[model samples]
Target: MLTENESIIRFFKELGLEVTSIDLGIASEQERSSTIQISRDSYPGVEPHLVTIADIARWFPELTSSGDIRLKQPQPDVSNCESLDIYRQYWEQLLSVTDIIMGFLKEYRTRFSRGEYPTTSWAHYFMNWTHETWDSRRLEPAPIDSWICYVDPSIRPHIRELNEFGLITRESCSGHPDDHPAREPFWPYVMFEERAYPGISAHLFTLADMACWIPTYGRHGFDVSLEIPRDVELTRGNIESYWNQLISSTRQLMPLLEDYISTSGVDFYTNMSNPSLFRMPANFQCKDMSTTGDFSR
Candidate 1:
């Protein structure tokens, strides 16, 4: 375990090779008050009670191991309303600050591994790119209700109707529909549905087999819009390299993730313990304090 300040410093030092001085400078400008405000916004009804680093260390002693702070009893004077309110405010503020700190840390780790500080937000950009790629790659309009299933010899008669309706196109070729000019057979529209019982024997179709049949009979030309960038192609050799970098960055940020999960867990447990935290219908039973009979015993 480490002190809050020590943890913060260690995070920066570990990523010093990838982080710019300007990044650190910008992060330092985040004020304690702003963090508190954000926390209040996050949990609307709950008042924050303690926000300082020392207070956090006292409450969550697992964060530090210099001494056993967890053994100390937290004695609050309930008579002083002002003191209680102040404490709540500080606690809320600390939550917000910690969130911001973790976010920055994740961003730094991702950017470092990627070898670029994305000008736009990386998450938003990735989502948009994926959507665009999907749109460009889709050759034909999708059916309203498409499903895949196995094709039994008995179901061939029913499938003929599907073929007549132009729902499925079949072809024969071994290469990708977009890249291979070979007349590969595939069936995109024909979906195989499974029978609930083995005795039912409904026709089963694997995705590859379905794809093989599509180009053989399907109506549209191949769509090559989802082509990868020349520099970013996912070749067999480079795919693992990309994954390795991602895993490394994630491992480095595990501590922050653990802290966030622990904090949230504490909040959830606290809320569950307080029956007054929720407003229930009069007829509803409060399960937390319920004395229901146990059938297992």
Candidate 2:
């Protein structure tokens, strides 16, 4: 029986985002409604889209190791420049995930009456139901930790970017020989982490594996997941359907994204091959959608 405003407030509350104020300026006097605003502190910062390499090193100085070849300038003893291309990949992935979630919320609010929305609570939809869609294979939510965030091949370029900026990074093939490109796919990923010690590093460690932000994109559509009597099961169809929708949604939001980035002092780089792309401030890298391997540095 909660009002839509109340539901939104509750939803953000569970996620630990503080609500700063509710502006009623747009509401007619007789309507008695307002727009809710979240506190700016909830966002990481305007400086970098994600955490910076310098900050990561400062927080986790244990990145250097005894066996590491101490270079004159800052550099890791071993390097897999090829795998480093994925460093900034997470930014778009994160943003894409966020946009889709917002899209879900908007759809939910539009389709359901204030008090008759599905689900016991908004948090349930936000956390558990974001990824479930009909006519799609269920996507198992991956954990959002240093392994996925920093060490994953998708963000290797991001790590290398950090290293180029005087932040020391480490990489080990871990007995996987470098001569065989055929076995490269199965090689264990290098950990882009500080080696000062074992436990003191502030490596990337987001709980919920970013799953908390991904809503089920299955058959029910975004709004259906928010309503009562919703089906939680995955439907069989083109697994690419949800991803396609997400891509379409991202395309739709590009104008707003460009404006927001500009206002936030961020730069856009369409070419991942640009040598300076990573060194730039809060840069958004947009590679050709068809050519994923071209960005490998």
Candidate 3:
């Protein structure tokens, strides 16, 4: 078995890539802090909590809702935004980081697969930053290309499972009517899928169609599917179960995902090391558990 560092190095070497000199210290620290925050929120008061947008909204309604009842409308639909320039800015920065990291992994994988010694710096950088932003919370939009590049193909099965469960919807990419360049190039020809849930749609894509549309554009010619859950009556119990199922599926796939990357010689780090980048965080972890399942259960 590969040590964590060795495994990372070997995985990248197998992809035939090189590492850059950028320090991942800040990113790693941010990720660790995010992890600790999530852990604390998840395990508060000796009980484990499920992480869902509704749960967070209930616990911190102030963050989500306006105080004046008259002024309150449904949450802003992130999908219908007339302009996403602000979101685009953040996304580009994140993608840049993913790119460098993945580039190194690709190079490392190329060397390793050929039975050659791997680059030491590449391995070290990966080990230091490997855990950074592994969870969904840190994953923002923008650097979606990196997410596609680094995500393990094994997760595709879970995506299919989610679709079967009515948690996601699969469609031809060309069917969507959105006209963004991101959406246009991949249309019609590529098969696509998307999440069916309203809450997750708002949180991740900031727009309802984003869970499906963004991937279509980012992946371009590749046939891809979106992974989202369907919105049912929001009850505490049902929401909890749905969240649990999704989280369980994601967690179960983590190891196999790493193995898949290693075996396939995919360069995850290089794809993620750049500053202007966006990609989905392929990993998921528990967060706050305060709300009863009724919020969406």
Best model per TM-score: 1
Over 4 Å off in model 1, which ranges? Answer: 1-35, 38-231, 259-297
Model 3: per-residue lDDT, tens digit, 1-297?
754334433433343322111122124423210011111211111110111221221211111011100101122234434224433333233333224333323322343344332111111121223332223221222333333433223234433443343333333222223323354323222232221221222222211121111211213322223322323433445434443444454343222223222232123323433221123232312232223211111
Candidate with the larger lDDT of 1 and 2: 2
Which stretch of 10 consecutive residues in model 1 shows the poorest summed lDDT? 197-206
Cα lDDT of candidate 3 equals 0.26
Tell me the whole-model lDDT of each prediction, alpha carbons only.
Answer: 0.26, 0.27, 0.26
Q: In model 2, where do residues sit more than 4 Å from their true spots?
A: 1-106, 114-232, 266-297
| TM-scores of all predicted structures | 0.22, 0.21, 0.19
Task: Output the better candidate (2/3) by lDDT.
Answer: 2
Q: What is the C-alpha RMSD, rounded to one decimal, of candidate 2?
A: 22.1
Q: Write the per-residue lDDT of candidate 1 for residues 148-257, one digit (tens) a residue.
A: 13333222433444333322423111112342245542311233211111100001111111111110111222111111112443443443343233234323332333
Between candidates 1 and 3, the TM-score winner: 1
The sequence of per-residue lDDT tens digits that candidate 2 reaches over residues 1-297 is 986446545665554345454432223433221223444234221111112121222111111111111101112223345222332232223334434434433433333233322212212222234322222322222233444243444334433443333223344222223323366433222232222111111111111012111211224323211011112221222212332333344334332333222232112222223222122233222211222211111
The TM-score that candidate 1 achieves is 0.22
